[model samples]
Target: MAKYDYDLFVIGAGSGGVRAARLAAMAGAKVLVAEEHRVGGTCVIRGCVPKKFMVYASEYAHHFKMAEGYGWTVGESSFDWPRFIAEKDKEIARLSGIYVRNLQNAGAELVHGRATLLDAHTVEVAGRGRVTADKILVAPGARPWMPVELPGIEHAITSNEAFHLEELPKRIVIAGGGYIALEFAGIFNGLGVETTLVHRGPNVLRGFDDDIRAHIAEEMDKRGIKVILGAQHAAIEKTDTGLVSRFTDGHHCESDVVMFALGRAPYVDGLGLEAAGVELDEDGAVRVDDYSRTNVENIWAVGDVTNRINLTPVAIREGHAFADTEFNNKPTTFDHDMVASAVFSQPPIGSVGLSEAEARHRLGKVDVYLARFRPMKYALTGYSERCLVKLVVEAATEKVVGCHVVGPDAPEIIQLAAVAMKMGVTKTQWDSTCAVHPTLAEELVTLREKYVPQGLGQAA
Candidate 1:
């Protein structure tokens, strides 16, 4: 048996690390969490919390414009970018302190420094020096992955810098096809920036369902965001006035700023995983089993570093599950399929389970239920915004394999869908239910009617 300095050594105090550290400490295990940066990690500092605030700030322009419809006299509307950024910073700082306090309250040692593997059983924190543990958890999440080359690449920024812009761009060209790209596009366009979304793929969001992607593209165009699909950015250069992007298709877009929502990669370059016998996946993410165990027997990983699912809640769950299984000997495991998620685009999106394409590709027959209509609130605002709900089911069993939605309050609405899906509710179950009137969620129940609820693969 290897005697160690602590029972659990946590690397990267992001969502996963913090949760694991706290849980392991509560289990009466000596825990030490090492964070190179802040306690709240990406989601709190850069990823979800900060970005969503930016999104909210961006949406106020529409709210202010539409206030006249509510019998309010509005002369003119303006946004103060500096004020929003300052408020965001203050909120982040407050949250960071809370995280720190929570760790201390749980009696876990918080080490503020970079962590590198000294051995399979040991890690050395820069400045703070060395520490050893019976088991080590790596929760080092991902960073925005920018392309490697370009002429004036220095002019391009990632999500990390997008939240702190001094002023909204007059013209912005956003690169990438991922959800980050779409979210940033929505934020920029909503704030009245002349936003051009340049996507290499035919659709903006690659991993989502085809219909959802197409719907968002249409809505983005409706919002005045130029959707340039199936286009690739070749190079970026600086003109005397602004940044210019040259596309492979012989067109150029000049913008005051260029941001890449380009996606993210495992932030595992400096943790010395190689020395610790931890293996990486094809895309350089830390490879781990379903139990969150790495190649190193006593070492485990969670969050974006593992690349299991890139959502914040997934990371937190995975981290807690790992601590429960390892420190508490609870034998718990993470179910990737059970993970539900939402995208905070202009008209937010949410999903749980298999996409329609995934269902069709994986199973010989799949049932699709789709519903689309304008929401009631939009009627009042004279906004033509639409909501879409789709369900994909296994043809033979009629198991509710997927739930998808796009429109307002998607993140909040998807949580209930996630619970229903977790309980194995089928199309028949949904159809037999009553819907709350004039709400977007009723669309879920409405979609079930179109599914032809006769069990999957059943003959007419």
Candidate 2:
């Protein structure tokens, strides 16, 4: 007789957990996946997939203007929030169903309930009886965080609630300067909402390349987003007209909506990690080794809960590696280095490897190549928006250590650039590549001149 009810008990049907469960079940292990909410996790349901759709829907406003600049007689147009919401909801449901069917097809059992640890090898699902497993994998993911103590914070919404707003706001004030805040600022502004972005820091995208940061900020201003720097939300007050967001500096902005995109926190509360003796880091993220193994031998975790690179693809890679190591008799560990990422802001951003600051700090001496130019698509238009492409090369090895792009199709461009950087492509090798004439991406290969900032040393 089997010692446990299942070979593997997976908690949360998010990307990582689902991937691990499917792989493990396919490997002939009995796997059960328990999720409290929908089958698809945040990325499919809220974070990435739906957010990208919003980005697409919001972009048409500018496209119409560009069409006119190209001599196309575009007629009147308007966006219907209810219709878009209904369509978006329908597609989300379909995607969630696909995740469900995939798990079933892979021979993994699904339980629609929250799963909490009873012990190292036991999980108790809410309203369901306890279940035993030889191993447990946690991939509960993360949730948007806001300061609970802030006055009238209840009037504010996070990204989670932004997608479900009944009607588009006339104006919005979004706090924070991270990718989420910037992306939403673009979405709202592109959709014709008077948008204001407030950040406590002097510049946005704190960890990104400084040049990229300055360029994006300027672009945001061009797009009509009021960028407020060196300010924090001191309080939120609800009035008859709208919500008032008062800044620490005593200034204020009144808007129909106030969103706190401060950041996300790992969804570890009430999961009974203490019961299983699973260790968590100082920030409440599950502490795991390279193999995604928790301190408790039989319990493992991946995805945002572990907080290692927080991107969905990274979570999936970690999950697959864990399953392969545990079930397929093959030891695998995902290489977290050189992972490419994208911000779906207006014009968008794609980046891989280290930033210029990181390269300079770590390697001491680095060569920087940068180019900024108007894309051909906007040549006829009055738009002054320009695309940015930059490369950071280690002076010693001449290897391209970083690639950053901002503007149209930046994400797609960076993805391909990541491949070369991953293969240790050097600066000379990158330049030797033939340019696809009359293209934005071609600028990457054509950048021969080393950009030197005035009054700065040679390393920049």
Candidate 3:
């Protein structure tokens, strides 16, 4: 007889949890998934998918301007923010339905309720009593964080509320220097909102390659997005005219909205993790080992809840690996190394592997190959937009350790570069490859000079 009602029970039907549930069930284990919210989790419901749609909507203004440079007569155009939001919502609903149906099709039962761990091998669905499971997987993911220390802080919106704003703000002030902050800054600015990006750091994108950070900041400024650095908003106050943001540096700005994108914190609240003896890290993230196993033998976690690489793809991979290891006896572990990612800011960013700073610290010495130029499309249009491609190579092994690109289609270019870096592609191999005629990506192979010690010079 089966020891429990379910062989596996998963809490939080986000990408990771859903994937794990489907895989385990397909492998013949009886799986049940409980979700308090929608099935698609953050990436599908409120994050990457919707954010990327907004990014596409935001770029039309630039495209129209570039059209003029191309000698094409463009008529006056206006954006219907409401229509875009409605369309975005429709798409999200469609994707969420697919996630739910996939699990059902795989023979995983879906429960619509919040779930809490009752013990090591049991879960209590809110208002639905309890169910026993031999194993449980937690993948609740994370929630946007905003500092509440300041007065009237509640008046500010996080990314969650940004999608539902009644009207596009004429002026918007954004806080933080991370991916979310940069992406929204670009989104609002491109959509013709007067945008001011305020960060408490010396520059934006703190952990990215230094050149990429500086170049993006410069590009954002050229596009007329005011980049405020090294200071934070002291307080947000509602006034007769929109909102007023007082800065710690004694300066202030008034805007229609104040959006904070500081970062995300793992969502483990009310999970009754303590009752199950599931441990958590200091940052409130569920603690797990290399294999996503929690302290309890029957408990495991993956994705943002574990706080390991917070990308959606990483979560999906971890979820799949868990199912393979636990159900298929394959003992698979997601290879976290060399995972590629993209930031959908105005110019966009595609990066993979270690940053130059990391390589310098880890490998002692590294050769940096870099190219920065105006793309060919801009030549006739007189667009001053620039593209940057940089490669970081380990000096001792000549293996490419990192690839970074910014500007047009940076994400697309960097994705291909990630494959090469993952396969340990060397500088010589890149050099041997012929250039794609007159293309921005061709610079990836054609860059021959190492970065000069001072400023932006090239090796002779």
Candidate 4:
């Protein structure tokens, strides 16, 4: 008789859990995955996938303007919120189905219910009874956080609700300075909504390069987004006009929608982690080792719940590594460094490795290469929009430690740059590459002069 119901019982079928389940099952381990909500989790259902589609839809407003600048006559354009939402939901459903199919094809059984750890090796599903496993993996991911203490906060929504909003708002007040807040601000503004961004910080895109932060904020203002800094929402009150967001400074703004993109927290509440004896960090994230093993030897975790590099790709890699270590007899650990990331805000941003400030702080003296120029596509269009490409090289080792971009195709450009940086490419090696003619990416290679910020002499 088998000692347990399955070899592996996976909780939360997000990207990480799904990948681990599939791989373990393929390795001849009996695996079962249980998800309370949709199988696709945040990225596919409510987060990145749907958000990117909205970004694409919102970008047409600029395309129309650029077309006119290029001397091409464009017709009257309109956006139907209901139509877009319906189409987006359909595609999300299709993706969710694909996730389910992939798990089954890999010989992994799945259950549709919330699974809570009853013990180190036991999980109890909502509808189903308790199930035992030799090993268990938790990858419940995270949820958008809202300040519950604030007055009338219920009137405000998060990015999750933003996707399913029935009607388009005439104006929106997005609170936060992070990528999610900025992305939605751009999305709403591009769709012709009067958008105002409220942040407690002095600038948007905190933790990004200072120049990138200032440039994006300036561009956002030029793009018609009212960027309010060093302010936070004190209250949100419903009125006949719409929603009134009262700031801490005694001022207020009325908008049809008030969104709190404050950030996300790992979804660990009511998960019965206490019963399972799983340790959590001070931030409420599951505490795990590099191999993703929990304090309980038979238990493991990955993805947002672990809170190490919360990107989806990182989660998938962690899951694969966990599966390899436990099932394939090959120990593996994901390298969290130099992971490329992109923001789908207006004009977009792609970045990899350390920020300029981080490089300077860690590596002491650093050489900075920066280029800001109008992209060729906007040359004839007469648009003032400019692209920025910057590299931070360690002065001692001459290694390119950071690459940041804020402009057209920045995400795509940063992805390739990440590959070279991951391979420990140096400034000379990066410069040796020939430039691709008539391309925004060409500016990366063509940068020769080192940038020295005013007041900071020599290397920064």
Q: Could you give candidate 4's per-residue lDDT for residues 48-117 as a string of tens digits? A: 9999999999999999999998789999889999999999999999999999999999999999999988
Clashing residue pairs in candidate 4 (N, C-alpha, C atoms within 3 angstroms):
none
| Model 2 CA lDDT for position 21 | 97
lDDT of each: 0.87, 0.94, 0.91, 0.93
lDDT of 3 by residue, 1-460 (tens): 8879999999989999998999999999999899998899999988999999999999999999889987889998999999999999999999999998999999999988999888899889976779999999999999999787878798999999998888888999999999999999999999999999999999999889988999999999988999999899998989999899999999999999999999999999999999999999999999998899999998999999998899999999999999999999999999899988899998989999988889988987789989889988788887788988998999888899999999788899888888888888999997889998978889989888788647535431
Evaluation by lDDT, superior candidate among 1 and 2: 2
User: How many residue pairs of model 4 clash at the backbone?
Assistant: 0
Q: Output the TM-score of candidate 2.
A: 0.99
lDDT of 1 by residue, 279-333 (tens): 9989999999989999889999999999888888889999989988977889898
**TM-score of every candidate:** 0.95, 0.99, 0.98, 0.99
Query: What digit string (tens of lDDT, one per residue) describes model 2 on residues 205-297?
Result: 998999899999999999999999999999999999999999998899999999999999999999999998999999999999999999999
lDDT of 3: 0.91
Q: Candidate 3: worst 10 consecutive residues by lDDT?
A: 451-460
